[model samples]
Every structure is written in C-alpha cells, then in structure tokens.
Target: MNRLDIIQALMGQKNLKNYLEIGVENGHIFFRIKSTFKIAVDPKFIFDATRRFGKSIINPYNLNNQYFEKTSDDFFAQDAQRVFSAKKLQLALIDGMHEYQFALRDVENVLDYMDDNGVIIMHDCNPQTAGAAGCFNDWEVGEWNGDVWRTIIHLRSQRPDLNVFVLDFDQGLGIITKNKPESTLLFSPEQIKELTYNELVQNREQWLNLKSADYFYNYFDLQRP
Candidate 1:
C-alpha cells in the first residue's frame, strides 16, 4: 500500500481523528487526509498557503487544519502543547529534515503527545543506494534520503518500549508503535551510527524488522487495495 493507503487504513481502524504532519512542503499528503483535527508543520511551505493543490478548499474538514511555518523543534517547544491542548495526537508523519538527528528528535517529540493507540510513520527509512543515503552536506540534488535510515536503527536499538519495523516499499516506510517489541537490538546507539549502508544491506531484515506488503495486510487484516 502507498503512504495514503496505510494512513487511511489506520485512520479507519483506530478511529483516529487527530493528525499531525511534519514537512508539509506542498501539502500533497496533508490536504488529502480528511481528519477532524489536523496540524501541519514545516520550515517553509512551497505551495500557495491560501490555495489547495488539487482538492477543494471549501471542505469543512480543511477548516479544522492548522499550519505552522516553523521547524518541528520550534513548533514543539513554542506552540505544540497549546494547539494540541484539546486533543492528543492519534497519527503523525515524520517527513521533515531527513537528517538522523532531526528525524530522531521529531519522533521523540511526537511520542510525548501521542494518543494511547497512536502510530507514527517515518518516511525514507531505507535508502536504496549510497547516493540516496549519503550524508546531507554531500548531497547534490535528486532524492535525498540522507541518513534517515539511521533513525530507525536508533529507535530499534534505543527504544525497546516501542515496536519498530519497516515496510519495504516507498523508500522503506518505518512504523513505530508503543506496543511490546518482538525483538531488541544488540547494538549500541554509537555502534548503530557507525554502521555502513553495505552492512545495512546485509542485515536489513534483522535490523529493520523488514516486512513484505502482505505482512502489513495480514497484520492489520485489511484487504489490499
């Protein structure tokens, strides 16, 4: 399933109405979610702030959405609690800065306000190539995954209370839940950062708890689209 499909499935299954999306550059995915309460955070939005990309602007669901043109850190520190005062977050997408530290902090910060049944979906957790996974400064252009996979490794290794895994599609969508983890990492956080992409290729299944598309379908008992 695509990102939207996975999200919508969870939305229906969990009865999730509150949503938060980090890195809503163009609102390609943000506006698509018909949530009751939603918040969009991004350092700078690329599209016209007043107009919808392709959807209707008059939909009342859109009116419930809030936008913050600030870094995820800034948003959390400055106004996160105030905006989310009435409702806890049920779903969140971490797609802001692709760097490991930023992505790591984004997940941690969101976890603080997540609802009991909440889930967090992290994008770009499996860079397909060295160029795709290169350190941020060395990136020239094109698709830059930028060491984000490291965050998955970090979470899996550091946060045993959270179940972590990756669906091996769409640059490897990382799934995080506060359920009991089936396994814990043997590697330390420092050793995890020292790991190379080649090593990841060899240990992807074990390290990322990689799953097939059917695994998700069966896990959630949701029919494939």
Candidate 2:
C-alpha cells in the first residue's frame, strides 16, 4: 500500500479529530483527510489556496480548516499555539523540510502539542539510494531524502519512551507515538552525522529497525481503544 493508504487506515482506527499537515503542496494528501479540525502549513503554496478546496466535502468536516502560508519554522514560532487553541493534536504529518535537523525540529515541535495517544507520521524516512538519504545543499541535483532517516534514528535512540515504527514503503513512512519514562540520547548528533548512507545501509538494522505495513496495521488495530 501507498503512504495515503497507511494514513487512511490509521485515520479509520482512531478519533483523529485534530489533524495538522506540513508541506501541503497542492493539497494532494492534505485534502484527502476527513478530520474535525485541520491545519495545513506551507511557506510556498504553489497552487491557489482559496480556490483549491472550495466547496469540497472535506471542507465541511473542518470548517475551521486553516491554510497557513508560512514555513514550518515560522508557523511554529509565531502561530503554533494560535492554531491549537486548547486541543492537543491527535494526528500530524511532518512532510516539511526533509533535512535532518529541520525534520528533527518538526518532530520536537509536534511532541509539545501532540496528545498522549497521538501519532505523528513523517515522510521520506526510508531512502532507497545513498544519494536520496545523503546530505546535499542543492535540491536541483538529485532525489535527496536529506537525511530525514537520521531523525528516525535520533528518535529511536534518544527517546526510548516513544514508540517508533518505520513503515517499509513509499520511501519509508515513520509512525511515532509517545510513551512514559522519557530518557536521554544514547548517541550524539556528531556521531550520527558522521555516518554515511552507505554506512547506514550496512547498518540498517541498527539505525532503521523498519517493519512491514502489515506489522503496522496490526499494531494500529490492537492500539485502538
């Protein structure tokens, strides 16, 4: 199944009333979700925002569905709490800046607002090629996953309290949930940053610890209350 399939499956299992999406280009996956409240953030929205989701079925589900024309950093810094009036986020997709630090920051920001049983999905966690997962400044060059997988590694190693799962599909869709007894990082950024994708490939089990879609499906099914 594709990433959307995984999202839809999870959405079906829970009361994901409050939804937030980062990097909503053309509302491709953003508009597909039927949540009670929705907030999409993207600095450079390519399509026309006002006319895109106009009069759609999902629009009514979230009448207060806001479109923030700003980067995740800006949105978090200035408009995060504003968007989340009182309710903690039940679901959030971190498909924003794919870079390691940026993605890590996105995860950190979401943790502050996420509910105890909330799930955060991050895109591009499993890179097929070294080029895709490698660090690169130029976006015009290759299919750069921008070391987003490192964020997964960071989360797994640093915060053992959080249940982390990498769905081995669609370049790796990461599913994260919070638990108790939060701990400190076992490895440093300097140590993680030193490893190359090739090295990561050699040590995928240690870093990624990915699971199949079926595994995730079962986990979510059993997780429902």
Candidate 3:
C-alpha cells in the first residue's frame, strides 16, 4: 500500500492516542495522522524553520502538534525516558536515521514507550531494486543504506516476541508489534555477527527482495510461532 493508504488504516484504528515521529522533514505524515497528541523530532530545526525544503506550506493549525529540535540518537538516548514517563504512545514512526546502528537504536528506545498493542511503522525497510527503484524518490535527502532493514532483522533476532511484518510496498515499510516479553532465542551471538557482516556485503537489490509478507506467511508463519 502507499503512504496515504497506510495512514488511513492507522487513522481508522481506535486505540491510537499519542503519536511520535522520529523524522519530521515537512510534517507530511504528522499532518496526516489524527491523534490527541503528536510529537515530531529532528535535529535540523533551522533547516525546517527556513522552510527551504518545501515543508513550510504544511498547515500550522494542529494544537496538539509539537516539534523538537534534537537528533534522533540524542532524543532516544536521553530524552525518551522522560518524555514517555507520563504518556502512553499508541503509535510511532521511525524514519529518521537510515544507518544500521542508528535504526537499531531508534527501535530500542521507542519500544519502551509503545503501548502493549501499539504499532511501530518504519520507512525504507526494503532496499532499492530495479523494479522498485523509483519508490526511494520520496525519501528526504540521504542515500539509502539499508540500515532500517538491518535493524529490523536485528530486532527480530533479539526480540522474538514482536510480531514483525515487512510491507513489501512503498519502498519497504516495516511493521512491528510488541506483544510480550520472552527470551531471545531467534538470533544467536554468532548469527548476529554473521548477519551484520552479511548486511555490509549484500547489494541493495538483494536486500530489497529478501522476503515479503507472503514469504513469511507461507514459509515461517511468524504470527503463529
């Protein structure tokens, strides 16, 4: 599905109250989501302030909207605990850093704030492919390095309890649901090392076609296990 369709589906959900977006370039997604409270973080506040990137036209009417001038890593490492202490986040979108370590850290930090049934949507989980090459045009301004994809893989290995699904469309969006706490048995230490190493060597095209929802459902039936 496209971004609009995904946004519509999320808006239709009744449980969403608080929403957080890690990368708010122009508030496109922020403006789309209807929620009681919404928070957007980005270190390039000056850039956004200038509205040079064509994000200035976004309506400035949402009372619950809040924009923070902070890097994703800084927000995750220091501010997330305090910000989430009083609020129950029902939805979060991680489109900030596309690097492997940064994406992994973003997920680790946001998981603490997510409600039991809350869902986290990640952008650019699938790498660029010949057929899907044009999809990356929507990305803000950096090169796609498949960091988000690697992060999702690491999360699946480290946290077996999450109901993780990769949306094959829209430049590869990843949906991960937190259910319960459990032992980390899916990924071993050796596996993590191997995967990380392999990620560095894997071509973008290969990464983009690694697996899709159908593949997971037919092969692993991850939802059941």
Candidate 4:
C-alpha cells in the first residue's frame, strides 16, 4: 500500500488523538494526520523549505505541530516517558535510525508512550525494493537498511503477546498493535528463530560491512547541520 492508504487506515482507526513521529525530515506526514497535537522528532536542524514544495510560504502557518531537534535515541531516552505520560499517544510512526539495535530501541520507546489500544506504523521493511532506491516514494527523504524488520523479528520472539502484521506492499510496512490480538495469529518461538536466522543469513554480507561501530564511536562528532 502507499502512504495515502496508510493515512486512510490511521484515520479509520477509532479514538485516535495524539500522534508521534520519530523522523520528521519535514512536516509532510505530520500535516496529513490532522491531529490536535503532533510531536515530531528529528536531529536535523535545518528544515528544508523545499519539502513544502512550491507552497513554502503557506507552510509556516501550520502551527499545531511541534518539532524537537534531537537524535531519535537521545530524544526517547531523555523525554519519551514523560511525554507519553502527559499525552497518551494514539498513533506513532518510527522511521528513524534503521539499524537493528536502534530500530529495536525506537519501538521500545514508542511503546512506552503508546496507549494500550494504539497502533504503530513502521517504515522501510522492504530493503530490496522501494527502500533500495534511497527514497521512499513521496513520503520519505532518504532510505536505510530494513533494520525494523530485524527488530520485528526479535519482538515476535520476545513478545509473543503483541500483534504484528507485516503488510505485504509499499516498502513492506509493519503494523504493530498494543491491543490484545487473537492468539491464532501469534508466532511461535521456533518460527521466530527461523525468520530471524534467515534474515541474518540473507543480509550477512551487508551487515558485516556496515559502519555501525565507527558510526557510534564518532556519533556525537556528527551533528545535524
């Protein structure tokens, strides 16, 4: 499915109120949600006016959204729990730091703030297709490896009670619901192990070649400018 379809599904969900987005390169998706309050987190300091397309002048008028310029990990570690307590998040989208560990942390942080019935939409699960091209159609600014997939695989094993659906199309979106899901759809430990193993084998070469170690070593050296 496309972004529009994702938005429609979110809109159709019952009792949705506040929304949170981990990576807001611009306010494109933020503006689409029409929520009373939107909290967008990104480390990038410069908000590209071009993201507003040719309608740049009209964009600043949108004041319902608030932007927090900080790395996703830092933002969550410092303030996520507090924010969640203040506003029970109805919807959350995680599109930041697509490394396996980072993605896993992002999910954990979002869940900390999400209401029991709330749903989360994870982006960039299809690394071979749409995400490979480095742009996620009209909704994203750049691409990263499908680390969220690895996280999902881990969560499937670690949290058997959570509802996880790997949507088949549009860059392989993953929908996770906190609501008590039907037991029939849940995955077994063996199945989770198999899936995770397969993914590791399939991406072993790329995984080994990743600059994750160096990235983290000099992480603070790199600032969003």
Residue 152, candidate 2: C-alpha displacement in angstroms:
0.8
Per-candidate local distance difference test = 0.86, 0.80, 0.63, 0.60
Clashing pairs in 1: none
Residue pairs in clash, model 3: none
lDDT of 2: 0.80
C-alpha root-mean-square deviation, each candidate? 1.7, 2.9, 6.9, 12.3
lDDT of 1 by residue, 92-165 (tens): 99989998889999999999999877889999988888778868898887889888888888888889789988
What's the count of clashing pairs in each model shown? 0, 1, 0, 0
Top-scoring candidate (TM-score):
1
Report the lDDT of model 1 for residue 85. 84
lDDT of 4: 0.60
lDDT of 3 at 195: 54
Question: Can you give the lDDT of residue 13 in candidate 1?
Answer: 68
Give the alpha carbon lDDT tens digit for every residue of 1-225 in model 3: 455455446556444668888887766667666665778898874344454323323443355566777998787677778777888788888888676677777877788788887778788777553222223344455445344666666676677677565677777777777754222235553565455434434643343334454553453223312
Worst-scoring 10-residue span by lDDT in model 1: 49-58
Q: TM-score: which is higher, 1 or 3? A: 1
TM-score of each: 0.94, 0.89, 0.70, 0.68
